[model samples]
Target: MSDFQSPLEAFLYWEANSPNQVFLKQPVNGKMETYTFAEAGNESRKIAKALQAFNLPERSHIALLSKNCAHWMMADIAIMMAGYVSIPIYPTLNQDSIQQILEHSDSKAIIIGKLDNYATQKSGVKDIHKICVGMYNENDGELWEDIIKSTQPLETITLPSQDQLHTIIYTSGTTGTPKGVMHTVGNFIRSASIMKQVMGLPHGSRFFSYLPLAHVAERMGIATHGFVIGAEFSFPESLDSFASDLENCQPHIFFAVPRIWTKFQEKILEKMPKKKLSFLLTVPVLNILIKKKLKQKLGLKEAKFIVSGAAPLSINLIYWYKKIGIEILQGYGMTEDCIISHFNLPNDNKIGTVGKKLSTVETKLSADGEILIKNNCLMTGYYKSPEITASVFTEAGYLKTGDIGEYDHDGYLTITGRVKDQFKTDKGKYISPSPIELNLSKNNNIEQICIVGTGIPQPIALITLSELGKAKAKDLLIQSLSASVKEVNSQLQKHEKIEKVIIMKEEWNVDNGLTTPTLKVKRNSIEKIHQPLYKSWFKMEDKVIFE
Candidate 1:
């Protein structure tokens, strides 16, 4: 049970100690293909040798575009094993974003994993080393299958040091163009070590990898940290079969984003409507029965812990899952910090806060109230973007997190809103919009809520109701939002309150660039989209005017 020193060290160690242990499982053509510890390390080393023989360039960056698959993980490990930095992008990103990230990162090669249209995306990029997996037929560049045949001998496995650069993860780019966050081997080791201790993740603990592998959530939550702790990773075929995969894998640890958590919540509420679930309260026996039934449906019967991250989670969402016997804990972190900042300790649980900061992780509020973090996991700098990196960190070395938060007396941190989101009214009261918006948007009827009142008298909500909250059932959504508003507004000061509410129609998504990939509202972008509507609505005094 000695420390492995680095991710690459962990890889070699696991291969030697547990060569037959299944390290990675990929669902290929609806069948499972498990890669043993020896196989994962052996395949990755071969890819690294192939990359070296190709002789791309020195300190070159390799970009990987794919979902969470074994090949993607192996390819990523290849980049590191070959002494190259890995720049992984979301598979959901469009062509322009794909081009921007590659060009910006100055990537020399691109590895394509299982996707519907690999050739289509490969054709668009003008100048870059392109290779595709599962493409046995002849291609200009080496196929992943053929490349792994030339594995570098275990004795020849060369990788960067604990302090050397390991990976560069791009921000979701919700605000603008994505920024490459640089992380080193030391960062990965420290963050993973802290997580292993905190979560008590065991060696060879099985995990299901379904989140976007390119993002920090999957990078740390599954690939980097999960593997470092000797956890086995399994890939889902696709989102459509995520449930079936979960049931089959029966992982000890589960990590999911907020949207998936909400969907899981919706599944529970759908079968046992809130009213019916509430009706069980009269009988304690019925409550226990409901918990067992919900747990069985979510395929979390074997989960040691269900962790939610990558976005802010509403308290109501946690409470809903709590009723169904899911111990959903919220974690707060970012790409720059390797996806761990705070998490609820295993023995103690809190709903709103993301829980205690990791041991030896330094966190404090700035003069403007932004969460500042200083830890071993802080990035070296933005890849080739020193200016931006310098700007993100202060003279004290703590990252200027751009998020506004407060610490409860017990040391748990509750995020209040974004630093830039605190808008001033004409009357001089500063409004925190997200808190109010989250309060109202908690209802199943309200799918999204964006609060805007920039350069105006007071705050106003621009909400988009769920499909079920449409014209026919408008009263239901309105009832939920109105009651929520009244409850939240009651706690705020007069000038800090929302003056009125306006319902919106169009859905705002990160794909459309209206929201970040993590689902945080791009308020600046939303302002542009709703400018004309805001002007028209400003002239009127009515609330809830029919569109």
Candidate 2:
């Protein structure tokens, strides 16, 4: 193995040493197109040469607008090979967000590929040179196919210095407009090295890249790490083929958000009822077979590491998986630090807490119990937002995580809530919604929940039903939810008791602007639309009000 200094160096090393090894697998029109290290390198270099032909300034910002696909990774390499900074925009982002990121980053060019809806988004890329991937049917601009045919492969590829800027990753913006987080070559190398060591990710591992490669976690954990370790990556063609693709790949490592884990659980439950599964698991021989079958069905039979992050996974969900011979390690980190904060390893697994910090990571709690983190892998700063960046860091240089957490005696961190997520009731009692929401999520019927008490005397739960919940009879759902609400309130203080459980008819999602790209509920957006009706709903006679 070569001692690589940067992501580009890692790619170069593999391209030189093991050119025949398969690198990328893309499912195109139900057929997998495989790219070897040599082939991928050739394509990336050719794209880099074509980009140089555009005559953009050195270190010019180039934006990538696409979902997880083979060309996205190649484009990243092309940007680096061309000595430019990459800016990745979330594919699900609206036109306004796309325009804001491109304009703010001052991108000279954009590589658009593999989008579900390109027509609506192409209007956002005005005045920028566009290179579209024709394979994915994104042909609004200069085609990628023509560039490779007409251009020569760049032969004078130069390695980037550690201090040179690598990419600006825009946050998915759970609250407000997304901010560009600046990361350098050194940051990527350092973070990837630490994570590769900590997670024991081996050379030539198999990775399934379904998560948005634009996000830091997926960027570092899968795409970047795969490059560093000479791993093979397979991408799902679309939502319809996601399960089949994943099942076929059976990746060694799997990382998903809490929402994805919950969806998997729902899918499993839909196939096998809870009562039948419980009885089957109680039998000795059948239990092993059932667990193995379930693992294979979920495409995790060969997974060496299964991780959940981006949001707190419900502890009950973890326990439920544990009973089925799978242990989900809930890790914690944000985009600011390149997601090098903490994780629960297999040997030292903790159920309710996000496990201990990485070897080079430093963590401390602030006066208000907000988690503060300091690490060499942290981002340089927010792009074009110096004042906002300065405000996020303490005088001692720790990033204020905004998440409220408490470390157990042995150092496992349990996230209680968010600092800004707290709301004051009319009676002057402050309520942190996260912890309450986590508890409420234990109810299988509830898919999403937010606790709000802005103008009311008591906090009320705004909830959307899970598939299991939606499939149940109205009377059954009300009875089950009412019991859950009663059970949760019984364990809380008088002021903290939930006033009522209001089941919202509309599900919060990215299209509706109620959730982030990662599926985290946008509390601010939810409050803006529903707060006015809170009082009226609170005064209703029903304990479980269906809205």
Candidate 3:
């Protein structure tokens, strides 16, 4: 059972028990600003009183647009305490998307906090009540400091029930337009209860929050989890200062997506070449010293538990990290599932699979091999899209996760590919690109890759080379890529083999609509952009085609 029914109740309990304990830390300019439980609770009550002064109808929808910061949590708590639904907008979204989410959710007011570029987001937005968290121009909105100072704290706290609507999070939209996924307070409480058990962190555990707070994984894993366990949440000032911030905090529990993990590996290899490190590890005494030093340098020596999610992690990457004494556990979940479906626990972990389902969640495979889940943590539905919501579930009420998967004898789940990502060739042969892509990505030279061959005889790889790969001579790079491709092809059937490799000059990113915020490749977008080049590349005689 959960200790508290709602997040606000959790905050209040912590405040009453440990009013002087620091709960949050955020960097401002260059110095760190700390917030105690008492301070945060008082500030939230003040903001709630200021919001109630508007006298809007009950259960008003309030939108928050900001990067990860201490004030962002304050705004979220205030929204819930005021009996309002919180809609979090990704700070990286363009003006058109920001406007569309605001209009779709029917938000009555907006709370603006720290952002990279506020003008771009506020460009087309007007006629809405804006409450700014920090410094802003007069035309932007009302100042947060001023409003909180003028208003009194709420005399009576409005406690929310478990079934009440809590948050409506909009999907990052890797395939198409974004949709709002509605989750209730009960969903959060139950998910947090299970996580509190799984993590087993003490009251003063430290967490570093760097990912987008709008994303479900960060929201539940960091924000909700911190609130429940009374953990200290730390936010970095900027990307340039991330290394220093991470080392200074030395988080007890760390979570990162696979892209970040790959980057960390590249950084380490730059300091000590892979060949030398491998040779050193073979020596008896030097191996322990080298691993300890490497972990300390990367600020992971103090991390008790590390997790990687949001995309498929290559087993090679997991093994590489393990050599440095950091065992990364991979997990699987989506926005609609409240981000607590499956996890690879310590001491019982499998390298390739996404681990077993949580004790609270029930899972089964559909007739077509799609993974289906039913759990207390599942979202209520997509907001305002009844048809789209109904189509995502079975008549028996299991959520159809769209990804094809298989289970091991021990009930561990291995995701094979997406149902929509599979394609057929002119010869009537179907291919699943994920397993093939994973094998090809074992090459350190390849940073990002996608396998595309919808209408051709055999599949071809579209790759964005890493910095080291790009710096090498053209002939040398081609030689390395060709050897890796041949090794991967040797394990595959004749029809499933990749005929050629195309080296792409352009990079894929969230800003360019090629990847989601969580770093998952937008396969549909990639195919649409590169499909026309397939025939031309296939006709080339060379096995490695440079574009």
Arrange candidates, best lDDT first. Answer: 2, 3, 1
Residue 7 error, candidate 2, Å? 0.5
Error of 1 at 232 (Å): 1.6
Give RMSD (Å) of candidate 2 vs. truth. Answer: 0.9
Identify the leading candidate in terms of TM-score. 2
- State the local distance difference test value for candidate 3: 0.88
In candidate 2, stretches whose alpha carbon ends up further than 4 angstroms from where it belongs are: none
- The C-alpha RMSD of each candidate to the native structure, in angstroms, is 2.5, 0.9, 1.7
* Candidate number with the higher lDDT (1 or 3): 3
Per lDDT, the best of the predicted structures is: 2
Clashes of 3: 0
TM-score of the candidate numbered 2?
Answer: 0.99
Better of 2 and 3 by TM-score: 2
TM-scores, in order shown? 0.93, 0.99, 0.97
lDDT of 2 at 16: 92
